[model samples]
Target: MEKRLSHVDDNNTPAMVNVSTKQTTLRTAKARSIIAVNDEILALIENGDIQSKKGPVFHTAIIAGTMGAKKAGDLIPLCHPIGMESCDISIEVIESKIVIYCTCSVTAKTGIEMEALTGASVAALTIYDMCKALSHNIVIEETRLISKTGGKKDYYHE
Candidate 1:
């Protein structure tokens, strides 16, 4: 069966989903972003974070990720405006890659997968922004939803 798009109306116009009738539940979502860098910059990040003019690299990205989760509705059209209960971001270095995880929680009618994704995406971009001065070889390889709980169903990757 072909899956219907929740954001599309019968008239084929983009529309926000109505979750007013749905019961509020504890919703949580986790997302991940991976960035690959060359050996030169990897060595610079050996201590785990880089100090840039904007501030500490991972520190600034964490703040940006939280902000992104809270403002996902403003950035993505057709998304419901939700007040996130909590948002957490963690950055880790594995070999020559930087791994970022953003988890968002909300007590609302709708799931917060979009918010989590937005957080991860923004965090990755922030890292790229801070590290770009060192090397242009930085690559944001992937951004994906790792898991989501609550709503009608729960999904977990791996």
Candidate 2:
């Protein structure tokens, strides 16, 4: 199996990967998150009553996701700061859960997988925060990278 951690040598000293020698490429990554809501919240979403108290939930999440993507490095330790060219977030209701997908792209030496993952995670958190008043049973679960392109190898969901 591959090593579980990077940014460390055999001695386990903290270090940042030297990507300066790597080629600048068009890097992109997609990540997903699921936020489960209660029946009352789901009904509000279906009836479009979610917008009565606040603006569109999905729209707010999209904006928050984009902002989160840009600040991933700040929020997470050991993450390399990167400037992204584009960040897009999509949210949909699947059954009783809200599914969030975030895609981030950049022309840089390093990939934007962390940015994509952070975007999706924060978006899910935002949804929970917005609906917590209705019910505290909300749960944010299963955040993962769906696909990544760039670096030495590319990965995609089968």
Candidate 3:
């Protein structure tokens, strides 16, 4: 069968999905965001973080990512507000790039893919914000869902 939009009604109006009838299950999603930086800035970063006047870059981004995951419904319309059981953010630097990973877990009637995606995006943005003064050459690239489990089905990229 062809896939249909879940956030629309027969009248074609945007609507929130009713997941009350669905069984509550363990749902988890992982997302990734990549930040490309120039060699100069990469040299400034020691370990996995860069310490700026504002604060430690990666550490602050991690906190922001967790908050973003929990408040995903507030940022996106039609999303069901949910209390996530876990929200994890990790950052690693390889060569001239930083990779951010966000994983969100919840036991709910709906999937947590949005939350994971939001977390990774927010974290990438935060990194850019902290380091923009050093150079504008930084690029936030490839915000994508890496994996998702539970709900009606599970998904994994490659």
- Highest-scoring model, lDDT: 3
**Model 1, position 25: C-alpha lDDT score:** 95
lDDT of 3 by residue, 1-158 (tens): 87789999989999999998999999999999999999988988877678899999999999999999989999999999998999999999977789999999999999999999999999999999999999999999789999999989899999
TM, every model: 0.95, 0.91, 0.97
Clashes of each: 0, 0, 0
Span of ten consecutive residues with least summed lDDT in model 1? 39-48
Q: Over the stretch 1-158, how does candidate 1's per-residue lDDT look in tens digits?
A: 68899999889999998888998999999999999988887776646788778789999999998888889999999889998999999999988889999999999999999999999999999989988988889899999999999888999999
Q: lDDT of candidate 2 vs native? A: 0.87
In the range 1-158, model 2's lDDT, one tens digit per residue, is 68646788678988778788999999999999998888988888744326636677777778888899999989878788998999989888888888999999999999999999999998888787778888899989789999999888999987
Q: Which ten residues in a row have the lowest lDDT in candidate 3?
A: 40-49
* Candidate 2 off by > 4 Å: 1-4, 46-49
Ranking by lDDT: 3, 1, 2
